[model samples]
Target: MLGRTMYALISLSDLENDFINPYDLTTRLNRFVAVEYGAQFVLTAALLFTGKWFLGVAQLLLTAFLLHSWSVRQHVVDATDVFRQLPLQKKRRLIMFGAFLFCFVMVTYRLIESIIHGLLTDEGRETAKKLFQDAAASLHHY
Candidate 1:
């Protein structure tokens, strides 16, 4: 469902650029963003409800990723506005750095979240307790 909505939005965007329908274009774009937000919201809710602590962390990181992507898109547009003023090589380098930074942050966030989840969750504590009890019982037998 999300994929189909995204595809339809992309198709409508292409059509808008080829032709001209300012009103419909704006409406379509708004709907697209709303749908994306809805999908994110649903995923987050699922994570919270299912006791999937890792998934919650991942969802938070994904939100950051989306924000970073938005920032990069804005930066690219701003760079284009000063195309003649800025050096082409410098602009290219900045864009590449932005892309790399975005990905790096996303991956780092995921890893950190995963580690934190493993360390802090009740499930981990319960597992540790069971392991300790099992080991103690074995030692007593010996």
Candidate 2:
């Protein structure tokens, strides 16, 4: 399950970089900003609901980075130039990427700690139960 979850996350990212951007679907997808922000918020909620608030926060930070990137792209005066980043902007991008690495490390640490300590709060158990029920109910409708 852990391997599958990691694969799904990586695949989603690869969907954009390997396929979406290369095929120039970005313009079609960005027809509405809601498509971008809506996804981030929903995924963040899912992460939080699963007792993974660190991942949720990391998703939010990624959203922030995307917004910053979009702002930089929008400000470009040259029509043909695409997302031309200034040196400082490039540095900031690196910093944000580093932050992502830090968040991933924290997530890994949390998972290991949970496994070693076997500590699940009552609230977390309840949330997990409810989430499982909801997913099961939704699956039945399909």
Candidate 3:
């Protein structure tokens, strides 16, 4: 199942890169998967299990690390350009702004993606609901 989802995502991304609209690719994939598998669950039960939070966090951290590396490379390029032509004070300020923007955009994108996925995906939504209910029940019992 994990392989299937990974393949689907990769294929969709490839198609999009090839100028095919993702919506069309997604719809076609959905229909094909539905007919072939009878059901489609993009996220698995394991993904929603409480024990997998660490895995999810790790994945997020890995993605952030990768993006940070790319951002740092871009900053280096920009800084080289600016330092060559701009005043030292102006270059410092621009570098600071670049760092701030990189962190802000990376964090915001991760947060928004997580929230949107939690809202849009059944596994995430169900897991959240189950967690809330369990907490409430535990409180009542107490």
Candidate 4:
């Protein structure tokens, strides 16, 4: 979605060549950002409700990063005359990128933790064996 916007901004031209219309651009950006926020907010809440605290907090960090990035984008675009915060805006984008990477790490950590937890203990070994048997049975059906 962000790529589409950038492509449009580059390929399309306005009188001033900054944007077709600042307000219209702002509105479109706001709509997508708001929808993304709404979806993630629901996901975070659902995760917490399901007692997935670690995952919920990780998801929350991603959500906050996206929301903050959107706000910075709006601020950059909503400037009346000339927005001279290019460096600061770049920093915000960097932070957003970092947030995505960190979220990836968090998920990987959780996956490894679960796999380890499911491997060491006796009960976990039985559970894992059961899972494999069930999975094999299901595969045989196919």
Candidate 5:
């Protein structure tokens, strides 16, 4: 699932050129902003719900700035242009590798966190369970 999400992010990046019709600048900008902002917002909300409030707010602010910053946007566009110059097969391979790396890192991170929690928080077991329940309930906003 994480790999799929990473693939979507890579494929939907503004750097990916049209194998079909050309997209206008406005359309490209809108799509990029929507995807970047939407993903960041969801990530921020998830982090906050899972009890990482500071990290969530910091990420939210940073991503908000990235969304608004013309320089950052142009930098991404430039990076994507470079990526677009790659051969199709190479591009596919790179994206797949990226997805795998992301998935592995995320899974490992979560596993480590779970292990640490298990070792350190025996008294908070019930609290953790309630927190997860609340987090799941919050997802109904979708």
Candidate 6:
């Protein structure tokens, strides 16, 4: 369902650009950006929900970077201004970005810690067992 929604969102962008009168460049760009945002947001959430946390976070980073780069290249609007123009209220924007940053930091820290333990520690096996018990439980008995 999430994947379908994402696909639909992406497709909507193409449809809007092609059929919404190509002469209306600003409208096309706005519609594309909004749909792309929704698609990326859905993909990120889907990846995280399916236990692909790293990929999910990477998708989010890609989304941000893509929007910034696209805005710069297209000269449609400043990337910072795009964010500022979100329909969200000030407090909501703060909380939303804050939560995203917190998750990114924690996930990155845990991944680095795991890597360091695997490479440099004698207790790597035990640490892995303890830290990934929930993940392990999802595996098949075979």
Output the better candidate (3/6) by lDDT: 6
Residue 120 lDDT (model 5): 60
Q: Candidate 6: where is the Cα deviation over 4 Å?
A: 1-36, 39-46, 49-88, 121-142
**Would you estimate the TM-scores of all the predictions?**
0.35, 0.41, 0.26, 0.45, 0.35, 0.33
Report lDDT per candidate: 0.53, 0.54, 0.46, 0.59, 0.53, 0.53
**Candidate 4 regions with alpha-carbon error over 4 angstroms:** 1-31, 61-76, 79-85, 116-142
Q: Which candidate is the best by lDDT?
A: 4
* lDDT tens digits, residue span 7-118, model 3: 4445445553565554554454445443323221212223335454644454444345434544654212132242242243234334434444544566578789788775
Which tens-of-lDDT digit does each residue in 41-104 have in candidate 4?
8978998899989778877887777676666663334434223443444455455456555656
| Pairs with steric clashes in candidate 6 | none
Question: What global local distance difference test value does model 4 have?
Answer: 0.59
Model 3 worst lDDT run, 10 consecutive residues: 36-45
lDDT of 2 by residue, 1-142 (tens): 2232243234335443554342343343234445545665676678878877767877777767767766776312221332342233335435545655666688789888787447667887788778879999999888
| Candidate number achieving the greatest TM-score relative to the actual structure | 4
- For model 2, state the Cα shift of residue 127 in Å: 32
Instruction: Report how far residue 127 has shifted in candidate 6, in Å.
Output: 15
lDDT tens digits, residue span 26-105, model 1 = 45434555466566667667866888676566666665655665566522223224334235324433443454455457
lDDT of 6 at 100: 54
Give the clash total for candidate 5: 0
- Which lDDT value does model 5 have at 55? 62
